[model samples]
Target: MEVGEMEMRMSTLSGEQGKEKETQSDEDRGYDENMSDSPRESVDSTNETPSKKTQLEDGSHSLSVIKKAVVVLTRLPEYKVSTLRPPTPQQFYSEDESHSSSDSDMQWEPEDNSSDSDFSVTDSKQKTGKPTQNDTKKTPAPQTMSEPAPIIISSAFAYCANEITKVRPDLPEEEVKVGMMVLARKRHMRWQQGKIVEIITRKDGRLKYKVNFVEKGKSLVSGHHIAFDNTPKLEQLYVGARVVVKCQDDKFQSAILAELPTRKNRLRFLVFLDNHVPVYVGLPLLHLVCRPLENSLDDIRDSPHKCFMSRYLRDWPYPHLTQYSAGQSLNAELNGVQQRCEVQEVDSSLIHVVFQDNQHKEWIHRGSIRLEHMTRFLELKEIEDYLDDSD
Candidate 1:
């Protein structure tokens, strides 16, 4: 009877264990049916929590890096920070850098914003792949053509005309008149005595004198090229007379009359210049030096004539010797017109100048050059003073 009861108990326990296993299997099947019904939701639900945690960790890492960069920037100087940053429009397009982009076709727009503007410009450039007017580079404007200043014809002849008129007041009206006996220079010939028969007026209203010479016949001459026929007496210019004569160096030197004028030499006197041999010079080239007291030739020679001659030669009266130098620009007379020239070489009394217009080179007397800047300055100052007076 006891053995039968034990078997019944064992059967009951086994039946209970089977019922629990069936219940666990039914729960697993229901779970699989829910996963199949919304597979994406199940997968997302499983991944969502871990992804959130990972994102939080990544955000913390980025924040730490940004904070570190901010701290480093804060420790740096303002100028250093600015150097690290991109340049502003004004800073980029400065005068010193303007020439760098002069040939570039890109245009630039000025921005008042901070670094954000730079990013926006970069984004725009990347999107369009072309430079716009609002870009960083710019094309400079086309320069305007300016009308040149008027060409001033400042000639040496003009200066001489004014100086000669000041020295001889009668030259302008009395000597240049018609029916005057004057010395006129002929073409390719020496100056000859002539009588002004008629005054001819040109189409340009310039007065020209028609002179009849004894040997050269009739010829037209300019008034300035003619001189009054007031010939000095050759007898009065005695030996040892102090005179000034133009030497081979184109400079007027103090000379002593070694011999009196003779008709055989065409009334030219034999004169001795300082440090030079005796030379025959005509009356036109000889200027006599007058003394207060009359002295004989022997007395004049015994006096301090050498000392006077040395001093006169050393310090010449002409201003051009000291004023002009090589590479200096001035206006000089070429032919009959005034043109711009550069001094190629300067000698004692002559200047070798090259014409700027035609590159023609010629040796000109130092007196023939006129400084354009000086004349222009004088004119401008005079005009300004006149305007001030009028006001």
Candidate 2:
């Protein structure tokens, strides 16, 4: 029993001892927890002041970056700006402007004269760039030709009488007088147109004149003459009178009389043909014609036959006879008998005749058949027809 009791006591003591140890361990755990809570409290306190310390560190870092940027900017050199600016009004006046400015700006003035006001506007406009009325005028173009008028002879001399001188085929009946002036075709420098001093006809049946003042200190002479036979009529002209004359050598043109001749004379010549035959006698050509054997001056005297012969001789134009009536009558009378004569020769004096019969032809001296016989022969029809056929 004793041994069992000892064992039970020892177990109770152990149980009590474990309870005390457990209590002491609980106290020690509480102390260690308190000690651990103090460290956490200290951690919370440090956490509360950490924001201030963090702000101070951030400020120091920002200050350091600003100081670095300031140092970088301060190390660079200063920059210059290159720019252009307009000049002011003061600079414009500073330049030399004598040619651009007026004298009024310098207080200069003209004298107060009336003419000054007239030119003032003109001068002002000229200085201010404007044209005046006179400045706009233009010069005219020049002319290129120069000539004079012509003088006709008729208009120059009008005192001369008009009369027919020498007529032409194409021109009108021209006038002739002592002082008539005419243009000369052959001698242009001679006194073709001049004062007539004297009129004379030559032995060869030509009229000439003594002309005066044709050239320098001298006179001119020409072979040309007037035809008295062809003059218009007695009433148309007279001697010692002023008249317009035509130069025969010219193509028959007329002009006024420049002067008159002091003398005039009739020209004389022997009749070359039979007196019984009428001949055309012009002082210019002195033409003559013989009448046929069968006709007489009585047959042709009052006849235009004289005029016809005159025109024929002077190379003028006139009407022709329809037939040779005298020749025809003579030829009819000797037709069958066959004793007819043919004219063989004709000259200024005589006409030789030859008769041709049935047997043979023979020559006969018909001695200048009287102008009356020639007239009859020319008038015969058969003779005229035979002459025409033979010609």
Candidate 3:
């Protein structure tokens, strides 16, 4: 019975010692029971190391709070950013401006973007339960954009490359018309690219063609714009064509096209006075014959001073000249009666004719001789020969 009494006393002493240790722990925590309602900072014990002398050998004391610690949040990458702001619920189809404009005018509360889970709004704050003062850092917005490649068109159509080959035949027939722009060869002025639109006939046997030039977002220009020209064209000056003869004054009368400068060569061409008579003149010297139009005024022929002739042929300085050969027989205007004559020599300015009836030699001016309208041009020749001709 005495041994049993001693065991009970030992049990009571052990219970009292456990109560004293718990009281000492509560005092060391520095948390009062009444102050439990106030905010309490959480301590991070992750980086704590065991001390050399283990005070927690019995596991009765608490560790001191860490002085410094870093907090990081692992969040999903926002690789697909639809907009700069937080994503909210949006309807795929929207009303017209009438209804949409009125909706924008009304006062509305800010939307709770988090409630809309359709679009996964990845936020760092959501990834981490709540940001503490130690790790309250911001993340950079994502870089996103979708755009198409640029397609720039300077012009709709460029000049025809065939001018050198199809038009000149002197150049290769390779595709060079692309990107090339056709401009007026007129001097002292710049010309835009022109597009041939139509062709109209004149009182004469010449057919007038129309050309158009469209500026960048400007006005429209037609063949009748007065700026358009028919000369230096691609057709009448082609390999072979018949024409009437006339006289013109030019400084290149002596210098050949092959010897002249590049600028002057462009203004030169070959003209046949007759089958045997060949002459070279500046391009401006020759006039392409005009075809009679359906509404042509034939009455203007009788009266040389008519308005149409005056307006069109105002620049015609030389009178029509006729072609003659050395042996051909013809009539002369020396006497009132018709006299039979024999051709002696043919010159550009003068023609020598001898009267067969009287045996009298006379030199007649080119303007005095009457000739037909048949004028011939060189059919074919090596472009190199034409360009390199010295005589």
- CA RMSD for every model? 26.8, 49.4, 33.4
Assess candidate 2 and give its lDDT. 0.29
Q: Least lDDT summed over 10 consecutive residues: which range in candidate 3?
A: 372-381
Write the residue-wise lDDT of candidate 3 on 1-391 in tens digits.
Answer: 9679757866765676577557655644543443444233344546532222112323455333333342222222345223334654445433221132211111111122122211111221123232233332232122331221111111101122321111222432222122223232121212333444555566875444444444532222212122212344443343222223334431111111111112312434544332123354555544332221222223123232233123222212212233456787655654545577777997543468788877988665333322111110011112323655855
lDDT of each: 0.46, 0.29, 0.34
Candidate 1 ranges beyond 4 A from true positions: 1-192, 195-212, 216-283, 286-322, 329-340, 347-350, 356-359, 363-371, 388-391
How many pairs of residues collide in each model? 0, 25, 9
Ten residues in a row with the worst lDDT in model 1? 65-74
Rank ordering of all candidates by lDDT, starting from the highest:
1, 3, 2
lDDT over C-alpha atoms for residue 156 of model 1: 23
The number of clashing residue pairs in model 1 is 0
Quote the lDDT for 185 in model 2: 21
lDDT of 1 by residue, 1-391 (tens): 8679857866775676577658756755765565532113112222211101111132344211111111110134456556677777887565544534322121222121122222111111223333444443442332441322212221121122222121111222233567777666564324566788998889998778888996768888765445556534444455445555656665455555543443323445666554323466677776543221233122233233344333222322212122466887766656557788888986443467799999998665332223333233334434655876999
Local error of candidate 1 at residue 143 (angstroms): 22
Candidate 3 backbone collisions, by pair: 160-177, 161-176, 161-177, 204-290, 204-291, 205-290, 205-291, 206-290, 206-291
Sorting all predicted structures by TM-score, with the top scorer first, yields 1, 3, 2
State which candidate, 2 or 3, has the greater TM-score.
3
By lDDT, the best candidate is 1
